[model samples]
Target: MKSKILLNLSLFALLISSLGTSLHAQTYGKNGMVVSDHHLSSEVGVSILKKGGNAIDAAVATALSLAVTHPEAGNIGGGGFIVFMKADGDVTTFDFREKAPLAASPTMFLDENGEIRDNSNHKGLLSVGVPGTVAGLYQAHQKYGKLPWGELVQPAIDQAKNGFPMSFGLYRAALQVSKRDSSYDILQNFFRGPDGEVVAPGELWKQPALAQTLEAIRDQGRDGFYKGAVAEEIERYMKANGGIITQEDLAKYEAVERKPVKTTFKDFEIFSMPPPSSGGVALIEIMNLMEEADISKIEFNSTAYVHLVAEAMRRAFADRAEFLGDPDFNPEMPIDHLISKDFAKSRFENLDLTQASKSDSSKFGQLYGGDHTTHFSVIDKDGNAISLTYTLENSYGAGMGSDKLGFIFNNEMGDFNPVPGITTSTGQIGSDPNLVAPEKRMLSSMTPTIVAKDHKPYLVIGSPGGRTIINTVFQTVLNVLAYDMRIDRAIEAMKIHHQWLPDRILYERNLLSPDTRDALEAMGHTLIPTTNIGVLMGITYDARLRAYVGAADSASEDGAAKGY
Candidate 1:
């Protein structure tokens, strides 16, 4: 009887484990490409790849489909960063980060008392930044795309015309809305039907407005979004709501090319967005510091290894706060002083094996994001790879929706400095250089990277966790090169981070050992255990087979690792 009971108990446990796995295994298509995060968006990309499109074509398709499917984050109303590498070792960066309107004054958000209005005059017209995504994607496709422009955009239009089944991620984001001012009637209509209950996952969610906007773009191309009537509607909406966005701002909007920040680790040369993107340059600095350590020799997840890496992160972040800024505007960005070999060495001078550093000096308190974002990486048979990250600055940005555009607007302007007296004519604001200006771009921590060995592309990776994005990319690369873990295993194994804020070392449990934890505690380091850092995805080339290797975050039951 006792033996039978034990057997039954074991069987019950096995059944439970299997059920959990099935619950989270995100859907994928038959061969070709894989989609994770939101099942439908991934499928949109996979559909294009299966249709004989290259990564560039698929990206445009996936991105536009996301507009109809995952409007909360996958957006047309927002903008982002893209990094691409061609087979010949040529690299480029596209900066469509939203721009302030021409009428945007440095003091636009200031009240009579001189304090910045909450969210910088949050809501109505003042909430949006000039959108760059349509233009940004258009530029990449024009240069590198193989499929017909209209062909790539068709999937998005169809999905929008019909609709897509929503998922938990979308519904959960809607149920937990914040800082949302539904001042406009169309905006209030987004989160629910007339019943006022939350929309259910897998329910068909359609945005006819989004379909119309994409249709206009499909008919006229990039001009439809930037210089045409669609652009006019956006401007009209803004100007009516006290927004300073003008026809001139819409006309003047252009996606300029910024330099890509790059470095090398072991066999691979890593490249990412430069300057204004604090994410990439900071990644280089952390890599420079971590290069001094032998990561693999130590026990995996041993406290000593964790402590060293976390300390390097703290130091690098301190420098990021003090030295980095947007180059075009500030013009004084100390690139040499920030990622310089000498500067990185100078940051390591204190080199304590023990204590966490205060972000107080860094002047950035906990940047617990009040936002939502997404990332996707693509590799074609031709050795072309792209890692792109885009956002509305926060989920359901400014909590305002565009009635005409069939999308929500970005409140990226809040990312700017809010002080009335303090100005950014210099672009240097102690540590917060990402602050706002008229037609100015905000600083973002979105790091999109590609790694190469001997001038040949090897791996392309990127993530979307705001400040955590830098550390996540750093550790993933370390796992692949120094730790020698397969790319998938490296991303899945575990993660820990220290953003130089409270000096508290944050990490996940079970992956790091008790012995390592005690050692760090002995050194006066306060450790934080956290899980679900966010999604990390990429495709790696298997040189021997000339095939592909890919991975996706599996925190959700609905994630997949698909490729051909």
Candidate 2:
């Protein structure tokens, strides 16, 4: 362990210095590509492809590497979903989303007065669900990987062991952690030195403990994380903290294979994550609503076009609030009826082009999700494409890390409705469908999507933003297919989000001209200005050119898209 640690440090110092100097904006690429939020992670995917691994193998490598390099959100200590398409046209979804422990109750986060409890739901170990990333990656590899699982995981192990230079984004996240959860475990255990100073950009940061953990997983598969020493560490951490996770929860955790939600928009057939993730249903619904409106005549991002898209977003998110949840927990949800053309037409007709509809006014024709997620898109030469999105929910999730193990835990429990009846502070009605239940998977806004035309992949896209994920993805698709924007332009374009109850349009400050914002306001739209909502990454396949156009969001300076 000691020798490996020292060797890792030396190698990391040499490698990061070389790579760090080359850090700059990456644009479109073809042949084979991996587009991710971090350059190192993207390179890891590219290396896998060069080694003869397929898109699935490259995606797993990128995901693991992100967990080490982009620790604020990317995670092995949390869970997420993977949407995959094989060259033969087979499509599937793997949901390794975290689950509520058996010991949990719907009202666990509610106080004696039946009010929602603060901090406990999202700031401690109780918020950490049974993580499924390891299992999810293993399951996907078992079915589609061209390389051995150990090989796919090694790059991340080396990254964590050898350390990497801190990027500005990660440095900012660390500073935020210091401000909000300064007393949190991460500060004391890993992110900070004995002097209590956070690591800054250009500094070498290593995770010897995380490296050891990754090695264990590489050797023992799922059991390495869920059933043995790692599990004991988790249990030990929870017992010492105020968490409720148990050895049983970790030992019994399983990643399930679910059907990808499939829909058609114009010339493309879109496949995305199913329930447990509200993304697919909502994305389809938004697309359907847009299809009903003749917005193609309007300029993209013009006042009129933005208004139509925002209204569609409002309607879809309203449905998301009322109907979506864990299928196992809510068996009566009208999954088919919600995504049907007839339902979408009715919702679309309810919208008035001249005015906005109150979120409360949308009748529950019934559908839908939130998360601070990370997404990566990979397209290999064999035509296999994987769009995977995962998260640790919130930057430095739960603001806590294990002293023994060296990764932060997710605050996904915050995704559930703390109070099942009355509406809470966020404006949406109190959520019942997504209320906590023992062993129930939490609702998610992660939409790892693939769009195909003529049975060939046209675009692969997804993003990371808490509630904005669905809309960021929704608008990006429209920007490309409808507005005919290039893949890079589509991702880099300004974005907007509306999650129903707030009854307000949140948009990127720079994207919408002041006149457009004024025009929308005149139309009775409540506008809130902000920076970019989501950090999107994607790759568009050009069959005619037989190449891939890998694109990363311009808003994310650390993002990269590499090809060879």
Candidate with maximal lDDT: 2
Query: Per-prediction RMSD in angstroms?
Result: 7.1, 3.6
Q: Which residue runs does candidate 2 get wrong by more than 4 Å?
A: 1-30, 179-182, 193-197, 361-371
Instruction: State the lDDT of candidate 1 residue by residue for 421-511, as single tens digits.
Output: 2423222232445555677886677888888887766777877676688888888887777777776777787788787765677677676
* Tens-digit lDDT string for candidate 2 (1-564): 999888668666744643432433445555589988888899999999999999999999999999998877788988999999888888999999999998999889878888767757777777878888999999999987889999999999999987787766777777766666454766554666546678766666788889999999999988889988999998888898878999999988889999988888777898988899999999998888877886677788888888899889888877787898888889988888878889988987778989877655333322223346789999898888999999988876777867678888888987877666656335634567888888998888899999988777789999988778988998889888888888877877888888776678998887789999999999989999987788889888766777888877766657788898
Each prediction's whole-model lDDT (CA) = 0.69, 0.82
Summing lDDT over every window of 10 consecutive residues in candidate 1, give the lowest-scoring window: 421-430
Model 2 RMSD vs true structure: 3.6
List runs of model 1 lying over 4 Å from the truth.
1-36, 121-127, 178-181, 184-187, 191-199, 358-371, 420-432, 509-518, 529-531, 556-559
